[model samples]
Target: MSRRILLVTTLLLAGCTSGTPTPTPTPPPVKSGFKLVAFDSCEQLTKDLKAAAKKSVGPWGFSGGMMRTFGAVPDGARSAASAGGTADKAAPAFSGTNVHEVGVDEPDIVKTDGKRIVTITGGSLRVIDAASHKATGQLPLDAWGDADLLLSGDRALVLTHQGGGDVLYDRKMPMRPAGAELILVDLTGAPRVISRYRGEGRLVDARQTGDTARVVLTSQPRITFPDRPAARDDDEDRIKANQRVIDRTSVDAWLPSWTVTTGDTTEQGKVACNDVRRPVTYSGRSMLTVLTFPLSAPKLDSGRPVSIVADGDTVYGTPTSLYVASDQRWRLDFFPGRDNRTVPQETDVFRFDVTGSEPPVYRAAGKVPGFLINQYALSEWDGHLRVATTDSAQQSSAVRVLKPDGETLTQVGEVDGLGKNERIYSVRFIGPRAYVVTFRQTDPLYSLDLSNPAAPRVTGELKITGFSAHLQPVGPDRLVGVGQEATEEGRRQGTQVSLFDVSDPAAPRRLAQHHVKNGYSEAEYDPHAILWWPDTKLFAVPVNEGLLALTVTDNGLTEAGQIAPRASAMQVRRNLVIGGELWTLYENGLQISRLSTLEPVTYLRL
Candidate 1:
């Protein structure tokens, strides 16, 4: 809701070993520690992906439809696999505020300073003053792809992925390059452009502690072999063509371009070669970048940029540390082509120290069992990091606590015999306690105690017909869960909000359960999409049909009212409470309603 405090922990860099440059061989080895590895040239990456693709994929029995899913994979390999930037609203006046997370601060599509509401889901940044209840001047967006806004004091940072976008900050620029732009806007009076930093990558996510913000970006190179044949009759021909073309390329061809536009001057160069670290597997090309900036700084480039040679899919951050996790299974070759049948069954955890530094420094890397469900699957506490994963082959979910040991993560505590024949539905970490929800025929909420890092164990388990996809703490021992209500056979019925009391870890009980028929909410997936105004004790979630509102208290949850959905799109993307009013954001405009009466205040069509 406002400024967040960063807490420093002694165990953050406890077992972290000094980073040393190690000369690595081809097909980089997977070690317990992280090392810097370069591709030598673009040719190496081109050749490797083709060979991996040919081996994983078999004959030409597939179409070109599946190739669009992989973010940075080589072209022509069909089938299998895919996959926010952070997203928040305002806080209520009563009990604390409605921030994105309990301790973590993530960027969102909309944020309010009690007096004004700022939203960015389209080509421009719209600033609405809560006091006036009117639309103010907007910052014109000029780039393509997705963009998000972050605010602190008199400054606002606009992150844009320059690929394909409809609205933009600069209209005269015809071609939106395949890069990114970090435009700094001064919010002292009317929004005015201050500084712009042009970069190469997609904005993964960002978090702010007070005025300091850490932004993560993933950059992939676009490589091509001019001499390579477009069509090959056999697999061998394809492989040789790839290798031949790759041999002629260099490393610079695969590196991302970087530039900073300050006033009338611009500086350009490639990301430093030695500042990157690579994973063991010859997975495709992608660089994980962490850039840090101060919100009150005069320019956007008044920060530092660091990168790792890894493909990060999920990220979790604390005030002093940031952890990035990647599932290297997608790079494995198990067929005649890069087929999507069998994915890797392991995850790689990399930790970076962000305490008292402009940018985070890579500290260590370790391997963990199975894959994570999302960012919530990782947590750092009590001088150790705990990860939640599910082994698809075994159909079991488990929690593992790892301690930093020099360059590796040594397992100090673990509990694996919990949920079987099912996957993890939700995971929430509250201090030394962990609540893991797994569902198959039913949802089992297992409580785990991690007070002793050497021996974390499950304290209790409660089963219900439906399941929770997201978990939130209503109080110290109470949790508010949002997910789908299901049948005994595991068929999803609709959205269900359940309250649980875990005062006694060994005997947790369901306090209240309310089911919304045929209703699905975005809070089930993106937790930032939830809006709980403490003043009225009303919780609002975006559903497929409309905005479902409910009154949540210690007693139970009761139906309040529903905000009318958009006429054409018929969907509510985000909802937030500011200045004692409810704001529902859609693709076209914003609907403001009185928090008490739930009556329409005004509509600002964009």
Candidate 2:
């Protein structure tokens, strides 16, 4: 069937099948004098009684009879399976060396052939020997101010900023321009620069397929003008002239380009940036990129880039094509409505074959209604393309699974009763189910059953006590979630590292919890990145303050070490633990140290 027709049919089928009401099984008769009351009715009665008692006699006296009669029911008892049940275990302890003094921001580490490759912000890359836990070599580049890094094979592509107009709302303040560029770093031997592409935003993702690499760039232009109250008729011209100068100055303060290197070199043809202001996502073989407008201004005329993911030969570009083939074929997936409101809507997957073709053919696949494709990831489940999406609009932010053709977008299951405002931030497909980190209103780790992709359900959810920013799957039955707890005074206080047991996707429990110090008011306190080192059973926290590493065990987390950064900025991907050493990226440069010794081998000053 044609893609569009198939999508319509699939949506129809989903509506019909999903709406087919399951016959409510009749409850067995209650024993003796017991009577059943619906949860909603009980809740209402509780509210009313509380209000009445507040205005009547003593609080306990007024509701005593009601509580005695209904509150003791066995069904109302908090079960071990419930969110705050006592059966929930404490987080496990993390054990390992405590390495400190490594300065870096938003660091990502990967191991290859007994060597560790560490990429950090500020445009410096370091290589560490896994066995020795020491830095073997380092490479620095000029384009390293808040750059992103990706590793594919041996080639590293660095995206830097060039120049673009900036905006300011206050006339007294100056306007600044946006600048970005992309630089390719060859990491096979002595690190050297290869190709550089200039732009306004950042180079998000790069995909390597043989000799060609596709690089994606975003440009954001913001111009803010002064708004002065009506002045006296005599002063109108003077005010207008002052406003003009402010407008002109706002457009000139452009920062230098920021760039980093990745291991991708395959050249995939380039495509123009999408004009949409909202986040755009593209699904690749194993990576996904979520592009959002510039942080300073609206994406009306200037495009913005938000998030990017790079892994191996597959790269996904956001806000353009829902799916991009390595050959550059673009598949556009509509939000299933005409208004095109940026808030997520039901997604209709479409197919575009970009291989050896120009102006790729577009085909509709299927639709996933009630489930909005807010954010997604691509994973391999039994060799099939396992696409996972976070549907924030649904009561139970759903995770849908689809076939590689983008056909058959099925609601395999959902995480119900996650509270009204709770949302799933990231979804990771591990084994038979998918592990998701729910944030905001409900802080918990949920395991979803994707075995039956069309009807996936939340089999288990374990409250982790704090808000989570990211989750990393450590094993088939284990996951590490990084989050933060705020103090009673409303300050970002401590880092909460939670480990979950997903042996039963329907009954996950916290295995451990570790709270770290160094909560900074100026820093973005959100635990942005989490990495699990199986070699040492250690978990690392990449925060704005610096890198925090902890050792995990059956008991709980133990402070392994912490590296304080020279200065605090949002650590987009600041610190990483590679080959048993900590690699940190700072505004000054890159810092490399051994995880066990906490000794610095080299500080490649940027």
Instruction: Put down candidate 2 lDDT per residue, 491-511, tens digits, no spaces.
Output: 455656677677766578888
lDDT of 1 at 537: 69
lDDT of 2: 0.38
Candidate lDDT (C-alpha), each:
0.64, 0.38
* Count: clashes, candidate 2: 76
lDDT by residue (tens digit), candidate 1, 330-431: 353334454445556788888888764367777777777777776677878878888888876666767887878776776766777456667787888878
Model 1 vs. true fold: TM: 0.81
Task: Tell me the TM-score of each prediction against the true structure.
Answer: 0.81, 0.52
| RMSD score of candidate 1 (Å) | 10.8
List ranges where model 2 is wrong by over 4 Å: 1-145, 150-154, 161-180, 185-193, 198-204, 207-212, 217-396, 404-418, 439-442, 486-493, 517-529, 564-585, 589-592, 597-606
